[model samples]
Target chain A: MKNNTTLLRVITYVVLISTTSILINDIQEFNFEQFKSFASWSKSVNKNENWFTSKNAIMWSYYIIITALFFWRGYLIYGFTHFVSILKEIEKENYFSQKNINYFKKIGNVFITYTINVLVLQFLLSVIQGASFNFFKELKNEFTFLIPCGLAFYLLAEIFKRAKTLKEENDLTI
Target chain B: MPITVNLDVMLIKRKMKSKELAQKIGITTANLSILKSGKAKAIRFSTLEAICEALECQPSDILEYKP
Candidate 1:
């Protein structure tokens, strides 16, 4: 069991490090020049053109939506860090500890929040690109698994809470 | 929470030290302290029996219900 936990910890660390590096790389590769041009464009506005319908406005909206998606992805990664915290608790033989329960709940919150925000951003991106947004089609996409996964984490948290209570009762039994 | 332990009172009546009773009852001194302080959630029947045998008391002497 200890070996299994050690292996799991190693795997988690590897995934976390890789994901962080990838996110950082993506952020670095993002077009800050377009944002700068958008700022300049706002200063030299074409008075006759509708602001919302302009090409620059659509491009700026696209960048903003992309940035928001990246932020949510980073938040999701932060949520994964809680798994390491939980594993540390388990290693100390605190499987049903309050900290573990809280971490599980936190992970659930992050997952659901990330999924919802990403969905909203995707819808906005479609709108900016003059494309139709189908909510059901979007839900059928890659990130949809996170919704049920988040719920499962919540269920796990509740189970851990019950186990913690049972453990306390057992310990206090004399 | 209304249920209180009276183990200390019983111990005083029998003139037995808490540690000695714990040893006689085959429980840790720490656990005996939990019982004495009423921090234990529940007591096993076997442990109560052992305590009763060692302290020469009834369960009612060690446990009490207060309104």
Candidate 2:
């Protein structure tokens, strides 16, 4: 069990560092010049003009969507941190603790929500960039596995809950 | 949980301390407390037989339904 926890800990750190570096790299590559172009638009422009057709509006929306993607990645990192909490509980010999169960449920929520939100944001960004958005291709992306992983965690939480109940009953049988 | 545990009542009638009964039954005082507090979900027949043998009483003396 200790060996497994050590391996999990290493994996969690690797994932955390990798995602953080990716997000940082993305931010560095983001075009700040788009803001300059947005600002260069005349103040006297017609109010009736379609906002979606404007280059500045597309760039601005793309930036916001990309920022949202960054935030979702951070949320995914936060989910991974719960593994530490679970390991701590196991270290204390509390295998079926309520805290562990809650942490499992929370991780499930974070994984599914982060993946779904990132997918939507990416689709929105594609629209802003005038690129074709393919739902099936998006579904085939690596992060899509997070959905099933999230549900598996949710199932684990429920199993732990049942185990907790059984432990309580066994303890009181005397 | 709806089934009330009357182990405390049986202990009072038999003049036996909770710790002593827990010791005889080979269970912790804390687990006996859970049973006394009616927080236990279920009890094994073996444990019930042991309690009955130790206390010289029937299972009815230790467990009861109120509702």
Candidate 3:
């Protein structure tokens, strides 16, 4: 599973970098007047103007790549939770094997740290994009949604930490 | 790092099959097999006590110093 995750991370990075390069090229050659006309056409057809504005199809490619990145992040979180559960089961059997315990602890720490980093990055991006679009009302709404979601994620990490500690204590008791 | 379980001896002396003992102990047959094979990581104290009481034996009788 760890190997599989590493492979996925590598794939995600490759795709993101490639798509970002294409996006840069598109931005450099964009014709604002032509783009405005295209945007109006897109609006009339109820489609996303940004999706069709790029010459290299970077906009559509970026949409797909970013969605994949988010899904990968979700998969990582799921893997971490599964690992925590496995550790809990092992601990229940009073198996205090130090090496195994340390391995799990390290994984948990990494998961928590990465989760925080991702959330911060997401919040910053949301704020920057919203402000640029002058969408203050939408920004406020997003903040309301983000706060609870962030808290829930934090709470889950806390629960996993407490469970790990309790399992350690149980092992020591025996 | 080695420990010994005397579950088999207790069951044999009590004229009980592993399945019967497992049923009375309220654990699955698979877990009973784990205990019998000495492959179990650990056993709960409550479970140990129950096993001893049910088989009319002592903890020392069910678990031995394996060195």
Give model 3's docking category.
incorrect
Checking candidate 3 for backbone clashes, the offending pairs are: none
lDDT of 1 by residue, B14-65 (tens): 8989989988989999999998898999999999999989988888987889
For candidate 3, lDDT tens digit of each residue in A61-151? 4344434434435434443444444444444553334434444554455455545444554545554345343344444642245345445
Each prediction's TM-score against the native?
A: 0.87, 0.79, 0.36
- lDDT for each residue of candidate 2 in B1-67, tens digit (9 for 90 to 100): 4588899899999999999999998878898887788777777888888899999999988888888
lDDT of residue A16 for candidate 3:
51
Better of 1 and 3 by DockQ: 1
A31-109 per-residue lDDT for model 1 (tens digits):
7786786678778888887767768667777888877877777898999899899889989988899999999999999
Better of 1 and 3 by TM-score: 1
Candidate ordering by DockQ (highest first): 1, 2, 3
How many clashes (backbone N, Cα, C below 3 Å) per candidate? Answer: 0, 0, 0
Which of 1 and 2 is ahead in DockQ?
Answer: 1
Candidate lDDT scores, in order, read: 0.89, 0.84, 0.58
lDDT of 3 by residue, B1-67 (tens): 3678888888878998988878887878887787788766677898887788789998999888777
The best candidate by lDDT is 1
Q: In candidate 2, which residue ranges exceed 4 Å CA deviation?
A: A28-56
